[model samples]
Target chain A: MGNVSVSELRYIVGPSSYDSVGSKAMKVKKFLQDYFPSQDYLRRLGVCVFEAEANLAIHTTSGGDLLIVIYNNRVKVVAQDTGPGIPDIDKALTPGFTTAPEMARQLGFGGGVGLNNIKRFADSFWLESLKRGTTLVFEVWNDDSTQFDY
Target chain B: MKINEICKTVDAEILQSKGRLHIDIHTAFAADLMSDTLFIIMRDEDPLLLITGVTNLSVVRTASILDIPAVMIVRGKNVPPETIQLAEQNEIVLLRSKHIMFVVCGLLYKAGIQGVSWEM
Candidate 1:
């Protein structure tokens, strides 16, 4: 099927953005579950949303914004953070390679799987980083096009 | 095993049941690392329980997002109020155990709870 935009939503992510700091990720997950496609798409979308949100919260200094665009057969997620870009994109994308602080590690994150998980779950992915910030955009198809978990 | 049964087997305290103690769970995935937990694709027929040493909001978040029915915190780690509150809100059963990860796994295994087999 041809790509057709269906709906779009955006949210700010930071310490003071939500009543509970990390609860925004769950909200995104719930929103997609109710409005987007289901089954494999929901599974993959859930992981991508959580990871992207976690990366924005744990890695960045000033937090970021998450934009979710739902298409006819896919969902595109673009997450952009403010300041202190990744020094090594390659290393950051590596599984088990992490620079997350101990506090984040204790929270079961910063295990270096956030970016890797996003890359694996997304049908197509793109990333850009500068000293000012980092931005990641990826898409997961609604149809059971392929199994990315394997 | 049912959520309540698993709790009794591991000597775990039922921190937050949300009236979900009767739910049957057949598979389990234990990890202190949430990133790894996210990698697992749980099957729908066999409800999964998350066994973790971490007592943080992310554990609850991971379980909630993945549709995991219950979470068992090992080593008797003190779960914060917010984590327990979140779990309750999500309707996810939260459990706490004094046993370490290895021991808890063994106990659950003996109780007929199987480790999750990730579909390839």
Candidate 2:
């Protein structure tokens, strides 16, 4: 197949945004599911991408932007936000670790698993969080080289 | 084995996914933290029962990503219309019950939902 470029798909949602925060994540999942239409495959990708968006919102900034570009049977997700930054990258990567705000925890988020989840789902992953801000980049090829559960 | 029987055991309301309410629940997952589910979750055919105190659009979003069709908001909390709406859109069934998560699990286990099995 040719490249599936979605540079056109991008949006930003923030703290003051609204009652529901994970809308962007939902949008990405829906788009991909429609584009690929694999019941088993899509949902797992949904969980991974949604968690990434949720972290940027609840941890980094009250708001943020997510860029989803589908290319060459590979999907790339870039999440960025304005926040204090991750003090300890190593600790944050820990599965049980969470720098998430109270609201996130109350809502069952911020347990520091977003990156981990994203890594597990995508074919490849990278992370950067500093005093300035944090950015996470993930890429997954459509070749089913990636598995969801095990 | 049967989803209908599982629902009855948990006293969970079949809010959105009626058609799937009774699907076989070969596996069950319980966690208030989203992180654990993302990494450890491993199984395809096993229908999942997501038990959490959270009832938000994100929760539904998580369920959708995980391809989990059934979610039960425990502690008898009211799942906002938006959350229910999202869940419905994702084709996920949401149930609300007054019982705490721990108690709910006990009942489901007794009712024969073995959580995730090693069989597959």
Candidate 3:
């Protein structure tokens, strides 16, 4: 048999761009479902990716890129945006805290749950924020035995 | 409850169903914030019905990703044709009610729909 190959997917998230985030998320979800072995893992990863993309669309000022890599044992996602970095990472991670504009709230977004949800679903989470941009990296393991319900 | 029953209870109009109104939904979540909705559905195993006054393409996309059976847009909001098209394409049952968010939630609760437990 031939050696198996990994799959990689990437997307560009534009600043203040609202139309394509959902579509990009859908594509990522479908890709995960096709390759991942566990349904629970797929669901969690899907939610995390969706929330991350939505945040990029809402908060970023200079657009960003989303990268997804599917390996034999895990899936990884990195979202990098060129916007003003989050001022208070701790406060921003709070479940109900939000600095989203009134329009975002009115449109059923900016509830301050996006990053929190991403943390809840990701097996490992990392963040880097500066004055110029923010980058988030999260991973989900394919092993079902190690999964925890939260 | 069946989606059809929820629709009847709220006097909702079917914007786009793709013949999925018969799908059973065990829990109901009311939120205009897509992030909150995403959080609840991610943790819950039961079928869900999302009720929101925020009618936007993202709403349909959220339901599709979470595999939510139906979405009821309250306040009789006029959803754009593109949103309706997206819902149809995703096979999500889209509904619109004349009642506001509070009234719609009350009506659904009265009609035997239960709120999602936030235990997680």
Candidate 4:
């Protein structure tokens, strides 16, 4: 992960066509680390982004975009993927529940913790998946200034 | 234990080293799942090592995200060149051992290295 001082960042990640999840996620983590002040917050955000990037890379028919918006009070992340959306969003969010194919399992992914991890880390989380696509949004506060009940 | 001693105990080959032989290691986390690895709680001063049988690039990526510093690939799995390259670029140490994951963890534990604390 390299550092670039910026308020926002976006990158397209895969349909498992390329092994770019780690590198791409690293870049996102580096970008956030440069601006975010809390180590704990950064770590939580890093885990969420890594999981989101992995999901987009492995599950989508076509790769998706990871959009990040950094603000004075909080940081927001949005992950969008095209086609073949999750039929059961609740089941997918359950820990230890996964529909990841064998290939993803072999790579040590699809442990069914991705969405839950995001939900756990983000101060606010939202997700929507239809027949055509899926969109996930979450935000983490920069500090303890704001807290929300999950 | 130090990196060199840990290597000797497991009979590990250093595929990539960042001159980390002398650094003391107090904690480690062993898992084949990158998702579980992400839940490991690592402090800035705590130099953690990752023990996994997985040979994919994501292993390195997970370690990098957690700042785990080094990875010990057990069961002598054939690692991809790109994974090694990524580790090199990130200055993350890579080690390979013929031993299985369980035995490697056992040896390290006996040598005073402890399992990492979890965020959960």
Q: Which candidate leads in DockQ? A: 3
Task: Kindly list the per-residue Cα lDDT of model 3 for residues B31-102, writing each as its tens digit.
Answer: 887877887844445778899987789898888778887899998889999999988887988999999999
DockQ for model 2?
A: 0.55
Off by over 4 Å in 3: A1-4, B42-45
| Interface Cα RMSD of candidate 2 | 3.5
Quality of candidate 1 docking, DockQ:
0.56
Model 1, residue A9: C-alpha shift (Å): 1.9
Off by over 4 Å in 1: A1-5, A15-22, A37-39, A147-150, B118-120
Candidate 2 residue lDDT tens string, A1-150: 455555547877575343455567677777776567666566556666677767766765456778888766667888887766888888877776776667667666666777766776677788888777878888866675554445
RMSD of 2: 3.0
Q: Give the top-scoring candidate (lDDT).
A: 4
Error of 3 at B34 (Å): 1.1
**The candidate that achieves the highest TM-score relative to the unseen native structure:** 3
Give the 10-residue window scoring lowest on summed lDDT in candidate 2 chain A: A13-22
User: Relative to the unseen true structure, what is the C-alpha lDDT of residue B68 in candidate 1, on a scale of 0 to 100?
Assistant: 84
Ranking of models by DockQ: 3, 1, 2, 4
Q: Candidate 1 overall Cα lDDT vs. reference? A: 0.81
Q: Of the native A-B interface contacts, what share survives in model 2?
A: 0.72
lDDT (C-alpha, whole model) for all candidates = 0.81, 0.71, 0.82, 0.83
**How would you encode candidate 3's per-residue C-alpha lDDT over A1-150 as one tens digit per residue?**
122368899998887676665778888887666576565677777888888888888898887899988877677899998779999999999878998877667677788888988887788999999978999999887665658565
> In terms of docking quality, how is candidate 4 classified?
medium
